[model samples]
Target: MAAYRVPHRPEVEARARRQTQIARWVGLALIWLLVGVLIFLGERAIPDQHLPWTPLSVVDPIGAATKAKAARTGEDVAACRGVLAKGGLTYVLAEDSANGFCSVRDAIQITGGMAPLLPADAAMTCKQALAVAIWERQIVQPAAFEAFGHAVVGIEHYGAYSCRRIYGQQAGPPSEHASANALDVAGFRLANGEVVWVKSDWDDPGLRGRFLRQVREGACRVFITTLSPDYNAAHADHLHLDMGGKPLCA
Candidate 1:
């Protein structure tokens, strides 16, 4: 009665240790399940355009997934045209042509959307047109209003489809223009009868300069390449925006 103690059992201690580890694993499993459910719900709550897996619609708001979705349109001509139609744009498919390294296929002439393109017949790839439409709606118009308190009435572009190499070089890689994959935006015409020329107003200390810079920055977000006056003398007279070749923003 004075000394009564139970001896420690190795088997019992081992069993207890195993049970603790099992409980820890079970808790971890529960935590992971809860986290997965939360992520699923979050994705469901977001818009389709914001979700990377959804089909792209040109009318969709510009979001993190917008650029990637737009880029994918280049892979399918029909899909790109479908996006344009769904966005309520007026466009006509241009006749397909091929000549040496200069070929234009799956290209379109956008007649109605935000503003008319000057020269009335500037044609570009469907993917390029889609990007232009989105840029005008999301970036250009908003920047125009913020800067000039007027809406853009027309877009003045140098050209879209040109059969020439980069800088018209006699020998080198072909330019985006060769396939109608690029747009040279020379300026914009505002509702107030005012014209903003990149060559003339690019350095203006007033609203014109601000508007141009803002649109250029937005173009960098939407297009794979955005070259402005700041890039080089070659692009000093227009903003060279394209969805071809390497990515660049200068």
Candidate 2:
């Protein structure tokens, strides 16, 4: 018997399913490409900028004196324009003060315009001129001479100004460094080609001791307070020199 039968187009149905699958993969690939392009452009369209640093404040009389000196001379306590001319440096001293620690200047003098004493135009109340004298005779000359077998070629420094508390003390005042009243020296090179760095030679116990002693002895003659690696780790990398009123050494 002849009977009407439903058409079974299985191949057609399978083909349709395959086309749907292909379309989905193509759509996904396009979406991924667009996402990658957007990411690349976003990264290139942005700009960068730098942050600013803050200034330090005065801690003790020495620091106050440094700022005062800077104000008075219209130059910083570590100003080296005049000294630099003689030694070939524009800024021999970097930082000149701290906020919570005490400091003292060295005593000693050499040239007139650049006497060991505070610069003539410094706005400090310190009346002692011997600090510069000590610095010249002991710290500056001896370090350079001993390390090099001749005179010192140059002085390397960390900084002088820092508006913070003393390394150990909880709170006294600000450090003299904060006021630009302190000078932190790192090392010195002698004309004979020797180097006296605080970080390297501060603990040799002999040469380092000799250098520290010389500088400390020099500091006694100049600044009111002197701190060195022998004093503590805080000063292990440099000689802290502060000259404002009296004198003390560590």
Candidate 3:
């Protein structure tokens, strides 16, 4: 018998090539799966301490300057207008909270970004107005009008919105003040022509202590965080106000 011969057919060769291609595809899929698993494991192994949330860098020099300017001019404007009417001044009338700059201007216009409560007509929020009214009737007005015989002056405040974090807090949630949810006050003025500045009075044992006590007491009914001169050097110039969650004074 002649030796049996096995002949290669084109169809058979094509089928073999297709099988090879399928195997390669399978291998690639497995590799991808392995990579995905490894990545998941690596993420699980990292510690939260090594990947903490960090606050954004400073970028609002103009805002800072504006705040300073506002603090200086806010009181003067209020005096000129008398009783600090809200819907009167051009800046107050044109304030569009949608625009960040305009909000700051409004803050400066009404409260100096840190002064006592404004008149109800010039208030940004009910809490703010209430606080100011209370302070004026119980503290500012009494001290200036009846006690000291002053004009019972109004207050100035820092704007209500910012896109930044609390000072010295590099890793945490967004600041309440940054979202139009908070306020930073620079100081207050008495109608007796007395200006009790935060930066200046923050460290004075007598004036600073009294101011902090009064503000803190008032803030309990308004802001969440009533940071004052006692909180830190940064707060030495203003009383931080937040109308968010529960009251937190520190």
Global Cα lDDT for candidate 3: 0.48
TM-score-sorted candidate list, best first: 1, 2, 3
Candidate 3 residue spans exceeding 4 A from truth: 1-130, 143-152, 168-172, 207-212
lDDT score for candidate 1 against the true structure: 0.90
| TM-score, cand. 2 vs. native | 0.45
lDDT of model 2 at position 34: 96
Worst 10 residues of 3 by lDDT: 54-63
lDDT (CA) per prediction: 0.90, 0.50, 0.48
**Residue ranges of candidate 1 with Cα displaced over 4 Å:** 1-36, 44-49
Instruction: For model 2, state the Cα shift of residue 67 in Å.
Output: 20
Superior candidate under lDDT, 2 versus 3: 2
Q: Write the per-residue lDDT of candidate 1 for residues 92-152, one digit (tens) a residue.
A: 8789999999999878999887689998798899889989998998899989999889999
The local lDDT score (0 to 100) that residue 21 gets in candidate 3 is: 100
lDDT of 2 by residue, 114-192 (tens): 2122222221212222233325543567565664457655556665545555663667666665455566677766656
Clashes of 1: 0
Alpha-carbon deviation at 1 in model 2, angstroms = 99
